[model samples]
Target: MAFSTIKDSITFHPLGDAAIVIQAGADIREEIHERVKQLFTCIEQHPFDGFVEAVQAFTNVTVFYEPYTVHQAAHLQTHNLSPYEWVKGYIEGLLEEKWQGGGQVKRRIVDIPVCYGGALGPDLEEVARINGLTSEEVVRIHTKGTYLVYMIGFAPGFPFLGGLTEKIAAPRRETPRMSIPKGSVGIAGKQTGVYPISTPGGWQLIGQTPLPLFRPNENVPSLLRAGDEVRFVQMSEKEFFSMKEAER
Candidate 1:
């Protein structure tokens, strides 16, 4: 299904009985991300009878709803289409309207403090060695650019970011680590992200953050959300320890 001619060509795929994926595009690009976020906002602001929530990703939004609620909805009874078909039509109609109405939304920028290299970053030297860059050069280049919070997936609060400078890009480690500490920052290819919880991962560890990214006890567990921007602020090991001590 075509949402608009202005870069967003949407395609729908059924995700079981109660959900569907609205794919705006196939590639990883900023415009596509923005469009995805806008669609998310539109759905949140003006949802249908059974609308529950939308999960964001690279170029898609997975919308979840109650099938029973939709099946019994009075206004929707006139439509002969099944719940899935009606929901898809609802999204497509909104997309068409948003395109004609010039839909635009603001995003938030978040600052992340990181202490690059050293023991905190076990593989920092390896990344530099592979890229033919000094550790300091790698740090400078990594922190210089602003990254987009493309989505929150993989683990709980793990943010899939874009806009990592190609110069510092490095492949994931050949062998995965047993247990990566929470708040560890790493880069895999052109993607840079932090470990929100202890998990096995292979991204080249560059540093660790003291800030908590996931809090299960909170109403909204994830520290960051889709459509937010992130800037990494470099700090010294001394400062890291100081911050940790203060948090304790």
Candidate 2:
């Protein structure tokens, strides 16, 4: 679907009974992502009486709320609407209002050093074969492009990044690995992402970074978040190990 069409008529749908989804676009584009982040920021800054939290996704924002509090809101009693409807109306109002401080979001740039090929990137050869390119070319192309974090999902601090060039695009493996090491950078279709924690995945592994994406003890647990830009810098095995040891 065209982004302009979706932008003209933003959809509002209920997620079960406690949450509502505000769809900003039909496809994943930076403009659509900007709209989603803008709405997310607006909602986070100006929450309703029952608002809990809002999660930003590639094309929409899912808002969670306390249903009982919404139902008990004295102001909403006159409308005789359900909690979802009340929240929807509130968000619709927000859409019409000028965003106070959401004109632009501060995008953070994070450079992650990666060791490509060898034991760290077991599927590197496979990815090169699939794309009809040499392993060195794959690394060159992958590192040259900057990626945008559309959202964090599947695992804690796992960023679903966009901006992967079609030249090195590779499909997911037919069978997913039982456990992919944390910080493994992989490509699936047109997207690339890092496994923040050790987990099962099927993306074509091309490299691995030594950085810790998830920090359980920190106030902000995720090293990366939605709207951040990631740059991959190639490193040698010796450097990777040195950095890994330094991290330890």
Each prediction's TM-score against the native?
A: 0.92, 0.93
* Cα shift from native, residue 47, model 2 (Å): 0.9
Clashing pairs in 2: none
lDDT of 2 by residue, 1-248 (tens): 33343446589999999999998878999988888887788888888888999999899999999998998873667778989998998887776674543355779999999999999999988888988999999999999999999999999999999999999999999999999999999999999999989999999998999999999999999999899999999999999999999998
Stretches of candidate 1 above 4 Å error?
1-3, 6-8, 74-79, 98-104
Question: Where does model 2 exceed 4 Å of error?
Answer: 1-7, 100-105
1-248 in candidate 1: lDDT tens per residue? 23556534778988999999988788999888877877787788778888899988898899998887988883567767778888888888777775433455577889999998878998889889989999999999988989989999899999988999889899999999999999999999999999999999999999999878999999999999988899999998999989978866
For residue 42, what is the lDDT in candidate 1?
77
Strongest candidate by lDDT: 2
